[model samples]
Target: MAEALANPELRPRLEAFDSYPDATPPPLAATEELTIPGPHGPVPVRIYWPGGTPSEPRQGLVWLHGGAFRFGDLDMQEADWTARNLADRAGAVVVSVDYRLAVEGVTYPIPLDDVVASMHWARQNTADLGISSISLGGASAGANLAAGAALRLRDEDDWKPEHLILVYPSMHVDLPEPSKSLQLALTEMLPAMRLPPEMFHSMRENYLGALISNPPAYAMPGLADLDGLPPTLVLNAEYDDLRASGEAFSASLAAAGVDVEQVLVRGVLHGFLNLSTSFEPVDDAVNRIAGRLRAAGQNP
Candidate 1:
């Protein structure tokens, strides 16, 4: 993949970023592929049930993958591998949602609606699935969707996630600018990591369509009132433009009196979650997510 980029010298680092030391996914007790009813149609999902017998109601996680709202699938490492890892470590049922991407006639609410529906389905079936609770989480654009759905669930239905996990998310339509030190470091180290505002504007426009002129708060979650939301974990990549948004959103969550933990991973670019578990930060982030989910289930 790096061969196609302007900097061929980056091939080694980029390859390492993409490859896991062990390509095989961690073992799971079981995995089921099925469809959940959605407003638009059926939303496909993969459920990763952890290995071993449960002593109590296991935790559940409703997860989504990032692709700028137009790309990605349940098969991506961020969705499948992460779900498997989380399930194994947290001993939780990880529901990886194949929510509708924003493409062609599909737009903002359509994709977000799919996620909300999936969450409702997961929560309603917790007992049948032998899980006590479920949390909502995602990476990048998927994180944007997760946050938007969290607000919708809170306002529209007075429902809230047990926990929220956001990884390298770009939450705002108007993103916060990177600090001078960050900008300098990115330019000096990985200039390709710099994302122009126009790119983000275009990504939002592509996702929002006609709603681009006046997107609702749920459509651009950073614009929403974040009060009454559940505890959250925000992981931002060290060298990504979207780190600004993650940092800003973390601050917003804290100001809203939400329990929020923000971690800025060093020496990495965005979407590192898609990389192999051999990457120390990626492994650590997944472990942290697992530990939190496990604790939430136990406490609840």
Candidate 2:
């Protein structure tokens, strides 16, 4: 763990966000900008279709951006790049959603409502989008939305996604029992990563609103009944706090007879996917997701 932290390449890029330098955005073919009406207000979405082969029907992916549910938008450079990469790599149309943040909206059901609306919108426009099947996925808080969306879709709408992908998702508000190695890793990495404990508590409080009496399984996927969720791929950083949540979610899925794949990427931290230069694990995880999509598309 010490050696991993001491790696110069990893050290600098991890701290890059502190200074927040701007870099060139990845080139995408074309983006259709539009607003989908939600209960709260207009929810913005950017639809990205890869350049080439418009003749064939494609797979669709509804991408939720991550910012701990407090600070992300569809227009961010990282989100745009992720959409473009997923579209190009998976040969799928990507609809990136700009859902209401918890800080602004302050509620339990609001974010989940937006996610469900986004999914419905994507499904309704499948003909125009030229896709037969759809998947839901995201990184961090986005993955939280994906998990919640899947549950809501199954229970409320009786619809199932073709696939679900979670990248270092925060599925539980509670921390897991710490193993010795995990403890060591967290001790070294948490301080270095500069994740404030108070900030997380604030985010959770904002998302839960006043309805904190009972922990809803919808808010925490690990607590939910995982009987009918789609086949899932859960990716986690070995040193991330969310690692336990991902593992627990995977175990729940397996116990409920759901097909599940969980991958732990070593020597990576939370939000690594956003750091393109420093995070080689993101590329590998994306490739795996694309392969899974291809197989699902072929079989479905």
Candidate 3:
């Protein structure tokens, strides 16, 4: 498996994620870098305020970036670009969490604790931040943490997020079987672009450690009860393997009577949101996300 991942044949496809074109993020009214107290330690965060003076209180979002749990940071396009676009378009304040990665000795509950702490900070300071409501969301592994944090908040604090914006998340410990058409579509993808089942298995091992066999309740939220999670917007990449997990989780959310919107973004691969803002799908997804955040503030 390691050999396959290291194959020179896959280099170009792999490099695309790091080398993809990026444009300057739209200007925000202000961007602040701060640290909030966390269970593990202080968690760093970058906050992006909307560019305009708003007539009403804005929505607040705690956003996390994705790297299969161990590889992303606040500066990544998934974090910076996504936050900037959402703040600008949604007219909301976006707090991008620099949660601890699941690496070295860090594992379950550490990153989760960071996300939970960030949410608490955002919620407690909502008034000062000029936001009326708060939502929790992320992409891929970050999405997993967002969902886990939401469940933790629900059970431990009896608090509920205003909404969830999961972008191409991997929610299941075991990747669900893809539909026949999806399998065929995935076959056309480059080797490095596809997230094989083994990759998910390895990620689970790294993130969950010895508990992967019987992970805790919120570690893999797709397999947990979803009774009262907030209205969720799940965006799945049309050609990504994790689409199965996203689709299944959305179905479970609906089954549990939670409001859920599942959108399969067409003709895109995994981590599409991390690409340049010029990408049409990325633009469209940001618009949809901002629209949702705006609605949450207006109605809440």
Listed per candidate, the RMSD to the true structure in angstroms reads 2.4, 3.1, 3.7
What candidate 2 gets wrong by more than 4 Å, as runs, is 1-27, 179-181, 194-196, 277-279
Q: Identify the superior model by lDDT, candidate 2 or candidate 3.
A: 3
Highest TM-score model number: 1
Query: What TM-score would you give candidate 3 relative to the actual structure?
Result: 0.92
lDDT of each: 0.87, 0.79, 0.86
Worst 10 residues of 3 by lDDT: 9-18
For candidate 1, write residues 38-144 as lDDT tens digits: 99999999999999998888988999999999999998888888999999999999999999988878898999999999998997898878888889999999999
Local lDDT at 65 for model 1 = 98
TM-score comparison, 1 vs 3, better candidate: 1
lDDT of 3 at 263: 89
Q: Report the Cα lDDT for candidate 2.
A: 0.79
Q: TM-scores across all candidates?
A: 0.93, 0.89, 0.92
Q: Candidate 1: lDDT over CA atoms? A: 0.87
Rank the models by TM-score, top first.
1, 3, 2
